[model samples]
Target chain A: MEILIYLTQQFINGIQLGAVYALIALGYTMVYGVLRMINFAHGDIFMLGAFISYYGITKFNLPFPILILSTSLLTAVIAILIEKIAYKPLRNAPKISLLITAVGVSLFLEYTLSLNAFFTPNYIGFPRPFEIRSYDIGMFSINNIHLIIFSVTIISLALLYLLIYKSKYGIAMRAASHDLEITRLMGIRTDNIISFTFGIGGALAGIGGLLYSMAYPQINVFMGIMPGIKSFIAAVLGGIGIIHGAVLGGFIIGISEVFVSAFLSSTYRDGVIFIILFIFLLFRPNGIFGKNIEKV
Target chain B: MRFFLELRKLIFLALFIYLIIKLVIFSGLPTDYMIQITLYSFIIVLSSLGLNVIYGFTGQFSLGHAAFYGIGAYTSAYLSKVLEIESYYGLIPVIFLAGIFTAFIAYIIGGPILRLKDDFLAIATLGFGILVRVILDNSDRISEVLGGSRGFVGINKITNLELSFFITVFFIIITKNLIDSRFGLFWRAIKNDELAASSIGVNTFIAKLIAFIYGCFLAGIAGGLYAHLYTFLHPSNFDILKSIDFLIIVIIGGMGSISGTIIAGLFWVFFIEGLRIILPSEILEYRWVLIPIILILIMMIRPYGLMVKKEGY
Candidate 1:
């Protein structure tokens, strides 16, 4: 019973952490869906978003909710600008070129943030308003922040679902994902849709960034690189093109990683996650929530 | 017809002599730092050649190639240090042996992961790279000889500019020949269209395996030389960032282009190191900013890289 309870608690923590991954993974899927290119820099963008929001709340003395909102917008604008400058010109270039450019952007952001005196290499401190508390139920217990991460993630995910599916922008986005040419033919401005997708994706990732700062507190400029790599795996696990698949993939990866570390040596944890990804890729390339394999 | 005919055979003969003199007789550059930079650049070129085989020729975007490099460094470094009593094949044979050993490891890991395509494969490969590093960090004996956190140390240095450069050129010629051959053609075709190539009697799987194995062998060879040159080997030596640095090289050079790889390797190594030399201490930590920005600009301008289309590849 105790083991089960322990497992359950670990599982919940996994889900909460997974939510963070899910948010990051969503950006990857969204970009991939529209452009058929992996935005390798997206992870670093999330990293920067976290720091930017940290500053907004701390140095600038902005309210918590407003900080989150502004951070997303700021991240979105930067993403849009980056797309306009770097990716847009290479629209017709070979896939390898774009992949390389993504690396370039990633490196640029990582080092740029590192250079920022305010955003020093030392860990950025966040003022946490949420009370650190815990709750124990039948076979499981979790802290207040975990609860907050869990609830906020659920709410954010729900909101994203509604926005992606219910809004007119959502319909256009889906159409664009399916067939950009036809979508453009049907009087939809795909350029705008693509930028909008980048915007929304960047905004959501910003929230993930802010939430992560609150939970973990330890961050460096290069922090986004690992999580970015991990979330990208989660995105692939969930299916690269599907939005919901990104979410499911995130949770599965997150839970599996924590539990694998809990049971096995932490050394093998990444190896195990990679093994799982490899197996899935070999057997079921579509991923947990993937509908179909989209061609590049 | 006669000139073309004679040219082909002469090219090979000249290449054969070049390899002989380059490997045996040529005493490398005079300056040690020059030798270090040259050697480092050569290794990058060699490893990038390996990467080009799997990634460029095979059309697989593998981000975990550093693991193979690490494997090569550690495997040969350990053998050289421990087996020094027997003196076993000296430094010369260990180069080829290290290549063979790393090939085996690559064969094992690359098989399952090769099935993955695009982004999923990349991240999985990244995970694999990190896994290799973490495992290296934990092992005791590997730490003792190969040096875990402290890194493998106390190896005698045999690498110099001449040795490293000649070896790099030799590897490039070999890689070029492989890419030019039917085997190379098959890899390229698979990259162009996997299913279509498969339908046309190309055993996509086998071709990928062959490219991966050979590519890994080259990487391992480079790692062996790297371990010898630096006389140090640590988990940090072959981290994901190191992999990314190589990625930056190949990308900036122009993927799959041999000359591009060579040019990019030099430009990248010297440029990064050069920036460090020129920049003040206050800005030293942030020097990476310049590289990435330059890379992004280069990609923006010449999407295929500084070179145009790759020759034969």
Candidate 2:
């Protein structure tokens, strides 16, 4: 019974971890669905959001709810601006050009933040705005932060689902994802749809970053890279173009990662994730929900 | 007229080689900073050439070229350092062994991976590169010689200007010859249209596998050269960023152009080093900031890069 409780506790931790990944992976999936580009800098945007929130908490003395709202909005605007500046002009250009630009943007974001004038490369301990409290059920203890993360993730995902499914913008987005040229010919401004996609994606990623920092509490220039890559892996595993699949993929990766570290050496955590990515790419390149289509 | 053109080209080549030799000798010693830059540039050119073949010529879009390079470096480092092979003559075989070993590994991995088209292939390779780095960082369980994250050190400093120059020239010639051969035609055909090439009876899979292995082999050779030149090995040195650096050289130099790779490699190294010398210490860190801007602007202005395509005389 004690072992069962420990395992259950680990499972909840995995879900909490997966919540953050699911949030980030949603952005990746949505953007990929519309643009067919990876947006390699998405992770850096998450890092930027966390840093922005850090300033809000430490410098401005903003409350937790206000910090979350402002950071999401700010990151959303920045991501939309990046899309307009860096990606919009290359819509008709070669795919490789867009990919390279994304990489450039990623490097620009990382190094710029690491600049002495900016966030700097040093790690800053995030000031927790909330009191620490835990509730025990049976033999397992759960933190208030983990509960908050889970609840926030579910609520945000539900809102996103409604926005994507029930709203006119969602229809336009789905149509755009299916065939951009066709949708444009059908009198939809693809440019706006693309921008909207980026906005929502960035907002979700910002929330993810905020929650992640709340859990880990350490902010640095490169904090987003590993999480970003892992979330991308999650997006790929669930299916690049499928929204719900990304969430599923996220939970699976998160649980497996936690279990691997728990049972095996912590060193193998990243290696195992990569191996899982490889396996999925080899056996099911289309992912769990994606359909195999010949891109070439 | 064609014979005269060939003769003229040969004369120019000879003159260029003679000029390089004179410069190397006139520098007084191989240890000079200028010679050091030349040697490092040669290694960059050598490795970028491998990337050019897979990404530029074959259109395989591998993002893990640095992982293969790390493999070669560690292999050579282990053989020479742990096995105590000090003689340059003995090191020659070890270098070839490193290249062969990397090629074999690429050949094995490339079989299943090369099936995926452009973007998927890229992500897979990226993951592979990350996996290599992670394993290298945590390799103490396998052997303490790897030094894990602390880095492996004390390898022989065997690389010099002369050796690097010869190897660079030799690889350039070999690659040029390969591109001019029937194999090059097949690779271009596949790059242009893989389905069409396959329909035309081209063994596209085998052809791609061969290109990947051959490219990785050259990267391995460059890694061996780099390992000896630096006389140290660190997992950090062979990360995804280093892979991106190699790709930048290939892309900025103009993919599929050998002369372009050579020029870009030299230009990139010297430009960074020159920036360090010209800028004050306070502003020197800003060079990195400028580099990404340059990369983005270059892509916007010339998406195909400087040379545009395989240039002609």
Tens-place lDDT per residue, model 2, A1-296, is 97888789889888988999999999999999999988889998899888888889889999877888899999999999999999988888777778888889999999887999988899999987787699987689998999889988998999999999999999999999899899999999999999999999999999998998998899999999889989999999998989999999999989988888888877889899999999999888889888864442
In candidate 2 chain B, where is summed lDDT lowest over 10 consecutive residues? B304-313
Instruction: Kindly report, for each predicted structure in the order presented, the TM-score of its chain A compared with the true chain A.
Output: 0.93, 0.97
Total clashing pairs in model 1: 3
What are the runs in model 1 whose C-alpha is more than 4 Å off? A116-118, A135-141, B1-31, B85-89, B141-144, B191-200, B274-279, B282-287, B309-313
* Model 2 Cα lDDT, one tens digit per residue, B84-122: 887777787898999999999998899989998777788
Q: What is the lDDT of residue B76 in candidate 1?
A: 84
Which 10-residue span in candidate 2 chain A carries the lowest summed lDDT?
A287-296
Q: Is the docking of candidate 1 incorrect, acceptable, medium or high quality?
A: medium
Cα error, residue A169 of model 1, in Å, equals 0.6
Top candidate on DockQ is 2
Residue-by-residue lDDT tens digits, candidate 1, A56-136 = 866898876788789889999988888888898888877766887888898888777777565666675666656677687
* Interface C-alpha root-mean-square deviation of candidate 1: 2.3
Q: lDDT tens digits, residues B241-278, model 1? A: 88887777766666678777778777778776655556
